[model samples]
Target: MTQKDAPTGADATIPGKLPATGHQGRQEPAAMTSTPTTTRTSTRAPLAAHGTGRVPPRSGAVLAGLCAAVLALSGCGGQKGGSPAAGSVPDGWGTLATSGVSVSYPKAGSGSGGYTVQTAGERSKYNAAAAERTEHGVTVSLITIQLGFTRADTAEDAAIAAEAGIQLGSTIRSTRKVKLAGTGDARRIDFEFGSTGEDRTPPKGTRIEGVILTGLDSKDRTFAVRVDARKGTLPDADLKRIVDSIEVH
Candidate 1:
């Protein structure tokens, strides 16, 4: 039997895990100072003493101390914020969380269509995926949401990096800066696209609206959240709610 190409959009099955390949936050060595040591050696020194001081402590004890020191240095300077998400999950909504981030969405109902929560990762598309949900596929509604940690140093850098993913005919609508917890930096992007004639879902020529909100998480890790939907599939009110619901640890 011949294998079939998976349809694009929500029809694609998500892989079980996303390897975190994004740039990890770097830590500078803490300012350290050491007093110089002057050793005076005696040709016939006693076995209990080295050149000048008592025999060095056991290697195991020294190694344990050094390990603790390294961990202390590497663990400091962690910036924490954006936890306890901005708002409560909407009534009957679901949440997806991973890779230190979380997001909420509408739950499937008795009806055929509703929002979903997922961990979205496409190595070809994202640096580090956390939570994501693309509304529907297979001849149903249309919408997509994604949260990904980026490899950029700043929100501005990540925003520019994101532009590389725009489809051929898409048009950028607007871009703006946002604040997080009153101290963080963020960016919100809006755009539109005319679908290319493709065999997958969403049909051909559908007008799609897109919004991407990106920022540095509490720990200074870069993150990007995206939503794309057929012009009217998702309401603005619900959109704001979702964005407000993000929390990065």
Candidate 2:
């Protein structure tokens, strides 16, 4: 009875109480000690914030500014209203004065009258004055005057000179005698041939009508005036006016 029942409650309590104290200080809850949970962060930008489906404001303004600059530069040059300057010749007519001759031409616009004066000298074979006026869509009128110092003193001589001077390279159709009021007796030579191969102004194979006037001036000079036109372009009255206006001084 001594060993089996000697103080059983005290010994059991001592062994169990030591075990409870040791475990209480060392053990912890699983949620509290899970590697101290580091918060995760993202390194990528959102698609909606960067890839919006529209042109940027800064780029749109730049394009508009470029267009405005181009339009402003285009309006800087060129004549305003498409009209000629002041003190200029009127439309539908032109005047030219040269080589002691002056004439006004019809249907000849400003700066369209062509005049050339050649003097007689050793190097130059002859002295001549030529003028041409062309109505762009209608016809061409040309006048050539040759000064005859030793030859072409008479009307017949002037006619011969004119026949020799004409180099149209086309066939002659007819010749007749005509009287010019201001000038002396004159001869009219007509041609009904196309322009020569060398001439490119008129259409090829087009039958042009030419009227030439050969007259003797008071100073014994020979003047040959040629007026060529597309058929029916120049009226007889207009031709008469142009012929009558010729004056040599």
- Highest TM-score model number: 1
Separately for all candidates shown, the number of backbone clashes (residues 3 or more apart, or on different chains) is 1, 0
What lDDT would candidate 1 get against the real structure? 0.38
For candidate 1, what is the TM-score?
0.55
Q: Model 1: which ten-residue window has the lowest total lDDT?
A: 45-54
State which candidate has the highest lDDT. Answer: 1
Off by over 4 Å in 2: 1-104, 107-141, 197-200
What lDDT score belongs to each candidate, Candidate 1 first?
0.38, 0.32
Q: Candidate 2, residues 128-219: lDDT per residue as tens digits?
A: 33334344432233333334322444444444333332322333443444444344345555543343212223444544455555555555
lDDT by residue for model 1 (1-249), tens: 000222222122111110111110111234322212212121211111000111122244444543332211111111232232243467767765546455566666613345543322322233233222234343222222223333555555544444333333445554445443222455555565543324333555666565555556655655555555555766666666566665555
Pairs in steric clash, model 2: none
